[model samples]
Target: MSSRRLVVMRHAKAEQDGPTDFERPLASRGRRDAEAAGAWLASQGVAPDHALVSAALRTQQTWESVASGAGWTLSPDFDRGLYAAGPESALDIVRLVPDSASVLVVIGHNPTMAVLAQLLDDGSADAEVGASMAGDFPTSAVAVFSYDGAWADLGEGTARLEAFHVGRA
Candidate 1:
């Protein structure tokens, strides 16, 4: 049984000061929430073997804050594809992860993150969690799924939604 863990999250709230969307930074509340998200993951004893993050400023800042708060040493792979990518692109990215990584995290924009999480969730027995995740994904919200397949084989209906975490607002 080659079980794997996938964590998909939308970047925390970001500053509106940037001239362009890609240049926007995390807002004050975003920083705090990012740390809390890390703390919650740590409390659950969840540590990612690798992180695939978006290249945007806010996304990078979110991961940095989370790693610092969780006391985790994570080497992330930042790709532009995740910036405003759709669910299929997101799934393709997950499939590209090495098989050695048992746990992987992806931090990026919304809509896509939300769609990817919901697509993988399938009909997970936990109806409530599944419904909420598929409904809406807020800033700093994480959807954790367990997959019983290889990364290259990742796709819709192949994973179970184990839990969803939302940092303090």
Candidate 2:
């Protein structure tokens, strides 16, 4: 009953055929998707007390759209390590979140986000999330998990997947 919610969101759709993947900004569709996703989260009353975001342009742009649409005022922590981080790295970042925050959001890339969601999910709810882990996480996707303990105690099986949302149909 820690009341801590972890909202992990994959960055919005990014432009393709850029000079480099890291430099690619969010596409026009990405902005709309991000706005929709943020609005949806707001409707759920899932505003983040804190946010950790990747430093990539697409990720930053995605965060901007979501934060603006959600009316979020918390300053986000932009981390370079999150760009291509593995599941363990992502978990480490989550563990570092302050206990004072009732909710935290992480905006990052795929494969790692998908892996972290699968690893942390307890299967009590959202069976589809486990099955979907094998696939790639689309842009503006969110996986929400609730932990019974504090953020410092967050670990594998400590959380249960509360819900999952994807921007695309």
Candidate 3:
């Protein structure tokens, strides 16, 4: 089986009072949640080989907090396209990942993240994993998928949901 891991994360909680959505940063709760999620990833030995993050301030802050806590060594890529991307756009970014990488993480917003998770998951026993993701990829949530083929070939049934975790639950 191919060993490709995709870790998708939703940015942590942000101040609702911000002047604009893009300028909002993580809240205190968001900081704690991000740290918790990051520590969990570290405990699972799931350090990402590469990270692609949305350019939004909240998303960027979430990535930085998690990466710092995870002690990640890889430099992350900031992609503006990921900010409010749809499932196809998310898949497009994933398809660009080099097969040489064993793990890749994408940190972005919701609705899209939820949709992408559903698109990638096959109706296997792991359907529950996808269901969990559907419940809502709230702030500081991470969903993990294992693809049984090359990154370039990733799509639909080619990927299987492995785990879904959220900061609060």
- Which candidate gets the maximum lDDT versus the true structure? 1
- Cα lDDT tens digits for candidate 3, 1-169: 5577888888888888677888898898887788788888887779788888999899888888887777776788999999878989988988898778888999998888878877887766366666787676677888887777888888876677788888641
lDDT of 1 by residue, 105-134 (tens): 899998899888878876854887777776
Q: lDDT by residue for model 2 over 1-169, one digit each (tens)?
A: 6468888889998888577888899999999899888887887789788899999889999889888777887889998889979999999988888888888999999888877887888778756765564466788988888878878788887787877877652
Best by TM-score: 1
Which model, 1 or 2, shows the larger TM-score? 1
Each candidate: what lDDT?
A: 0.87, 0.84, 0.82
Worst 10 contiguous positions by lDDT, candidate 1: 122-131
lDDT of 3: 0.82
- Model 1 residue 53 distance off true place after TM-score fit, in angstroms: 0.1
Which runs of model 1 end up more than 4 angstroms from their true locations?
A: none
